[model samples]
Target chain A: MSAHAHSEDDHGSEGHDFAHPMSVQTLLAVFFALTFLTVITVAQASFDFGAFEVATVMFIATIKAVLVMAFFMHMIADKPFNAIIFIGSFVFVGLFVIFTLGDSMMTSGSFEPVVEELAPAVAEPMEVKVDGAP
Target chain B: MSTIEASPEVGHDDHGHDHDHDHPAFLAHHFDTPEQQFDSGKLGIWLFLVTEVLFFSGMFCAYAIFRALRPEVFEGCSQFLNTKLGAINTGVLLFSSLTMAWAVRCSQLEQHKGLVGTLAATLSCAMIFLGVKSIEYSHKWGMGLLPAGLFAYDPSNPHPTDHPNYLMYICIPFAIALAGVLLWLVVSAGLGNKMHVAMAMPLTVVCLCFFVGVGLGMVLESGDETAEHIDVHADPNGLASAPVMLEAEKAAAAEAAPAIAASGAMVSVDESVLEILAGDASNTGVTSGLNALEQQNAAAGTSTITGDEAVVGAITTTEIDVMTPTTAGVFFSIYYCMTGIHAIHILAGIGVLVWLLVRAVRLDFNRQYFGPVDYVGLYWHLVDLIWIYLFPLLYLIR
Candidate 1:
């Protein structure tokens, strides 16, 4: 629970300060996965995804982003609270995006048909009175 | 209490030694341990990546809306963009990401020589990526691909009436590619071993940032011009069928109705009231004249209001007028904004990378302490991912 607990890794007398966190194999595997994802993204773009085009591209990109975050970023091995912080930021941004989309959809254009239909039913007597006066 | 455990002689310096002095090589002061330090760095990068995704979502949203509104126009614009260049840039970025990952591994394993070499390799690939992007950008520029009024100076080269050349779409693609390359270089070489590469890293980063700033500044300003043009078109001059006389009549009616309606109880007015009423009728006469002129123009088929013809074509000519002695289009506006923002982010990424590189070079990192390098690499990769989508959306959507 102490902040100084993580500082234990900084106490070498040799003056060397850098520490390697990942193995060569892990690096190689991540490299291949990233490349594979890139290929897949480009390949997928060529097809007619129509309304799903951006969504599909973004979905694949999200996978690639996750891979980079997990392995290359060392997120997979990090503290649970760190992961929580990362996910929390994502959740906040996600909520912002979803709320914006929902609001935009809901407020789009006007539903004036109901008003139009009810106007005649409610105002017919008034219209007759006005016309008769004229 | 346990005799099985080995007991050491504690009569000497052991009595005065600090337990805290036995810390490992990788931990920073703020973290609980090397693991936690690494964890926090990784967390920071992930959070940063989320912001990036959100930032890029704006462009994707623009692309989606425009595509929905004018799929045919977008598709037509896409046909002019080069897919091959996009694919190549995608390949280059993917490779650079690989070398960046390798550089982190080399640092982790205490392979200083290998780390330096891999960092150099990653840097080289990044430069190559930039070089390729430059070539693509130059081609777009040379071919009048830049946005309207942003140095697209080929007046003699008028676009054919039937098919306007929307080469500016390629601008965003090349800019994204360029930003990707710069971001990679920053991660691998910019932040490797700081002490040895200190001067090199910062200087390279500053220079790259300057270039990116200038390039993107041009892009943003170019977009501003297009927006200005759109605003101009949206103003009074925008609609070709604005009824001047009818507007005058409506103004007069609005003024008179308030006064006359207020005096409804006193219907029997003097000659002054009659004169006022006659003046209002005369204004309506002017409106009728305007209507007659509109009808005459319609009968002659000289008016620009052809119902069957596409509105985009007429808007294109108006855009040309706005961009005349320049270029114009919403596509141009989007192109400049997307590429411009991406470039700025790349410059920032490069600054971090170079700083890490300087540290790596000075033996500041070891087998037990390279979390910064790995996290920097993660940030760099996310920058590249944005370009992957941007390139096709701008250039190869066809």
Candidate 2:
């Protein structure tokens, strides 16, 4: 689909538009909420969460992404198809990570490179003995 | 306004209006109605945004896999990043998204003044974001905290002024100057009492000039860094690229006078981006800071400085410790890739918005024909959405 859409009136004033725009107040509210969430995420990162760090940050990020897709991007008031596409795209992203990352973890050890020559030579310092020259 | 609804206005000309003209100048021939056109356009933008999501997802996957494989390295490298700057950038992008949305709403409402105002505001925010990013990049460059092969980070080693990132310094001034020009033009156009075409049109043209100028300038400035970018999977010699050597030259020339640190130039990669680097890791690189720390800590009180003091106070060994990062090269590689792509998108969005601003000043958009503004708004929001995720993942990974 093309990025630009052709309408009856470019600005669509010809017919009273059926679509509804969020009120300025609502838009501002969403803006503030996003900022608040950003603060929360940054603050949370400083504290050690051990294994939960990834999960917690990911969860917060998901919430922020949702708010953006919904209110700021108008997915909430937009066509269902558009919302589905956006959500489906993420689902696919999740799948991509799962297969690649999951498989790599499953068989991580003992997968050494066949060519020993390929390994970059680890530099070792010379041992200087200060006794009478050998 | 808070409880407003999308109910079609009574005056909508869905039925053939009295005007004999079949289509408005803005309407495309194929679209049956305005509603269809609007929905189709929105859907297309959503789809485009979806593609963008998938684009960044690949990078995210790479980062995740590497982090999973080398969790300790990732953690140690994460410390080298300045979280404060990341937070600032997050706020900048979010604010810009808000302004972009406001511009779309203004176009829809036929508020020409607000449309121009919001567009100008969004452009400024983007410039600010880029400026801050450039500063961060320069800081990294100066400290020699680079991606692999070129990774010379030694935070514990004292040598703050070792390698100044000339590229970043050059780009920052260019960005600031152009941003200032754009601001002055927008304000002049807006503040004029009369909407005189002669007066306002030039402002739009000038806005485009600086926007294009800054964009081009940024691309050229980063050209050096981009040229050095290698596919690390190839892992060739772990050779530091030419740009690293060039920067190192300037650094060496600057610091060569301090003969006190000559004894410290014992390691191969110790000097900031330039002087002591002779290509081979063993030729001139500083010994590992971990080793120095052990030796100094072991021999404390014998000299004027201790291990920690020597690391921070002066460059006595070939190994300079700046941003004591371990395995930071891969982490930074991912960091630059993700943020760099996002920054490119912002540049593209800026280009679109600049065009919209020109038309907006032309009074082309009424309530009926603001599709371009709306579409661009969606794109900008998606850019912000990605950053929302990036901030915590890259900066706050703990």
Per-model TM-score on C-alpha atoms: 0.55, 0.66
- The digit string of per-residue lDDT tens for model 2 on B204-301 reads 44344434533443443333232122211112542445446446644444353344244343333333323323221211122223333334434552
Residues B89-169 of candidate 1: C-alpha lDDT, one tens digit per residue: 566666767777787877777788677666655554555455445534544454344553343422223111222322344
TM-score of 2: 0.66
lDDT of 2 by residue, A12-109 (tens): 44466645567899789888998998899888865667789899998988888888878878877666778888899989999998888887777663
- After superposition, which runs of candidate 2 have C-alpha atoms over 4 Å from their true positions? A1-14, A109-134, B1-21, B155-326
Going through the candidates in order, their DockQ values are: 0.14, 0.24
At residue B88, give the lDDT of candidate 1: 60
Chain A TM-score for predicted structure 2: 0.69
